[model samples]
Target chain A: MTVKLYRYLEDAAGRWPDKIAVQEVDGSFITYRELDRLSDRMRDRLVELGIRPGDRVGFWIRKSIDAVATIFGVLKAGAAYVPMDPTAPPTRNNYILADCGVAVIVIENRFEPMLIAEPSAQGAYPAILVIGGAGGGVHLRAMLDEKDRHAEAPSAVSAPVRPEDLAFVLYTSGSTGRPKGVQLSHLNAVSFVEWCAEIFALLPTDRFSSHAPFHFDLSVFDIFSAAKHGGTLVLIGEEVGKQPLELAHLIADLEITIWYSAPSILSLMAQFGELESRNFSSLRFVLFAGEVFPVAHLRSLVKYWPHPRYFNLYGPTETNVCTFYEVPTPIPEDRTEPMPIGKVCSHLEGILIDADGRAVEKGTEGELCIRGSGVTRGYWNLPEQSRKCFVEVAGATYYRTGDIAKEEPSGNLRYLGRSDRMIKKRGFRVELGEIEVCLYRHTGVREAAVVALADDTLGMRVHAHVVSKDGRTLSLIEMKTFCSEHIPIYMIPDRFSFHPSLPKTSTDKVDYQTLKFWSGG
Target chain B: MTHESSAMSIVKEFILDEFLPGEEPSRLTPTTALVSTGILDSLATLKLVTFLEQTFDIQVKAHEADEEHLNTLHTICELVDSKR
Candidate 1:
């Protein structure tokens, strides 16, 4: 089996040239043959521009066929694709670009607003290849059109890239600092994809619906896992997500066989009663991750599309996937509690370590650590940070997931809570300290402490406890508006509660645990 | 006034009960913002369309699933009645 992401596509193209590889929401479909040809053209263009293996190429575009092409094309050119969400705040985008040190960025002309909004992007990259057309001041599609498609592909692309060589750098949040890029090798991704295909029993006839954005790790399973089995990958637009009725219609219209997304989407669907309305006869598998799946939510889902096998996936972007549990038995009628993350996936070993870093006994809570091919190499450009999380054990390495979990008597793993202060809201990792820093940056704010408010509707909403100077009152809407300019929509605190002074621990650090209770859970 | 009768009323009641399971009796008005009030998320909006189509036996088109028809309880009930 090919270790590279592009190689998987090429293998599929050779095996099923005429088969549909990806179908977009606009009814535009691309065959495996077309995908290979287009990818080759992009690769030729990248090579002509002097981009070689080991060079970082940022795919800063919205979800579309073009984004997928950039990922495959980057891999084909022996380069690593760093996906940057177009909707991300300009500062965050700058942080990622600066941290990753990418010389070039592949973006859509429509998304040039990010470049226009950020003054730092003026000279951020040496070259910015706009996908569609010439937006402002950047290289246009002429570069792609002028490429010699007939030219032989680079045989000696990068030094025979080992499974340990960095494949892609996925940027994820740290508890008290800027997002760090996780360096995952081709071997790490390939192994995870292989296991994913097997666990789901994916068939060539399966049409996997893609909803998660490119930056998110969940989308990796949708793209690579489908390509691995020569299955069809359907790209659903953000509009489909914004309008769930359209999403329901698309599932039936596109004949989507495999469905995987965050639990929020499914919970929302179950809330609206859309699951019971349509005949999703084509769907065979459904998986949810990035958060704890509420039992009541999953039950509502099964009530409609009961035929598909339901699965709860657990892992961090640092490790593509470590454990998953298929809902083998039907959920009980009175399931008020959340479902467990269940067992580890095949080809991986999981251990729960307690506070003292010793293996915990069965049924005892501890930090979940994983050792396998799926564990990423380390964080890119952050050696000091990388050494902190990735630790050597018996001469081998394991990634500390920072998630608290417990091992059942039957060896199944149950997710408890986060060992760190980091929180997952609507699948986007938010650093409470980072939010606090943003709050402190406000001119009117003297000091701040951000806390999470538990709401069943929108997952976890942020509430900032602040002490403003001169007793000036700050409105929640005004603070949210200010945060919107500095952070992504998901990171914006839903509520702001003013305080005289933050409650501090003995060591003078903000008492987050006490503040969590003060935020009314 | 097509849905003013007992038979149609039960359908509306069922729609409210299934969609807003734990909603208060006092809040089950003819018009309530289901989409805006955190009652429906992206998936719930889709599931609502399918649920209406199956329960009312009408194929709801993708484009028609916009806020005009599915945003509010009254609008959804009206759309279902018209389609039926």
Candidate 2:
């Protein structure tokens, strides 16, 4: 199989040359032909900069036509792309760059600060490549100007990447207190896309709106599925993301047929009353994942747009999407609790395993393990951590998703919670250890334990209970500002409290449950 | 800003009916703190913004609806009036 993500895009161009492949909030449209031409030019420029086959490149740009073009261009140049969210802290961004050992860094000038905040690229890479300006290393705009826009797609490299070759690395937080890069291969991703398109009944006329960033795995479904079937992809601007009303208008005005995003985002839309009087006549599918969807909110959405089929997609980034369950029809009266995660997808196999690594019988709870085409290869550059989760079963590897779940007699999977201390906030993985490390780095902090607090206002907020060293007092503002430098802004504690000492268990381990009680969560 | 006209009553009812759900619309006032006061949380804020935009036929740019504008019912009413 070809290792290029662009093959799908190229096919779309052939099938729909005049169709709008992407539409920006500024009203600028990138037709398939233009996307092909621009990506060709960008590929040539990357080649000119010594980017070779198997080299890892990166993209830190916002959601735009350039982002879509650059993703295809990197694959066209035989390089895998790593993405950095611009909203994330500079330190986290720096760590990902160093860990991936990315050969080339491709980012717009506006986001240059995120890359340069650290001393240097500490991994197996060279200089950064700046787009839209100069002064970093190679000026992408200048290189593009010098390249041939009409250049033909480069011939397949002599060593064409196999289906198992790494296609991209997505860095996510782990329970071990560090970010791990999940290595997804071409086969792993394209297979998931094929399964999704088939199961969802995607068609060429489907106009999909992308709310998640390119870095998020959910974007894979949007981009790959759209490109595979020559479907229209309407790119929502950052401005639209902050204002739910603007996003609703974009969806309604564009006549989007499929909507896929985090449950929190959808809840925001429903809570805003945007779903009350709006008409989404063309919408036929609404897919949500990343966090649990409250059943009440789901009912409200169905009330307004009853035509669209609603599906709760459940999976970790390591396995793109292994399980899905459509909400029951005739809407049950007792759906106030979180909905069930349901059975495995058509191409995946799932089972619940207890602490002894033995399969638990029906109605028994255990960690959910999945084996499927969508399961990622493993973490990049961390063999030990990879070995811990990806276990060989029946001569194939199965990933331990760490989500505690139970298999009912009906084979439906119901979620229990995390087996570890990690939590999900705003759809980003968060580890208590990561927050504690940030707290320890502060000057006046002697010891700290970060606990997640459930707040009705914000789903979940991190609360840090700290003990000042030598009677030193640290103000909330100071601790917040200090944490801003060490960790991503989202992982920082929203509310801080100073404690003399933390409650400990009999084994001397930090009693997080007692901390949770103290937190009033 | 008196809840005198039936149009004002309708808008008030829409806010209470949609956001507060079963609560009486008469209890809600134009000066009420729809968001911070627990009347409307983040999700309700989204619904309120959408309600205002569609009912008034106006586009609410993302940045314009910051904390100051969305925090209270009076502020939201002021924002809607300005947009109108």
Candidates in order: C-alpha RMSD to true structure: 7.4, 7.6
Which of the CAPRI classes, incorrect, acceptable, medium or high, describes model 1? incorrect
Predicted structure with the largest DockQ when compared to the true one: 1
Candidate 1 runs further than 4 Å off: A116-125, A133-143, A146-160, B1-84
Q: Can you give the TM-score per candidate against the true fold?
A: 0.83, 0.83
Model 2's chain A TM-score stands at 0.92
Error of 1 at A220 (Å): 1.0
In the range A258-334, model 1's lDDT, one tens digit per residue, is: 98888777776666536666789998888888887667777877877878898888888888668888886467797
* Cα lDDT of model 2 by residue, A1-521, tens digit: 33356788888888899888877765677778777766776776677667787777777877777778777778777778898877667777878877777777878888876575333344344556567742212244354654445453353332255677677888887655568899988888888887887788899889987887887898898888888888888887544664666677677878999899887767667766466556679888899888777677677767767788888889999998888988765466666777788889887888888888878878999999999777887898899888898765557567999999998777789989998877777676788888897778777888899889655435576788888997644654356557666665567776667778889999998898898888886
lDDT measured at residue A401 in model 1 versus the true structure, 0 to 100? 88
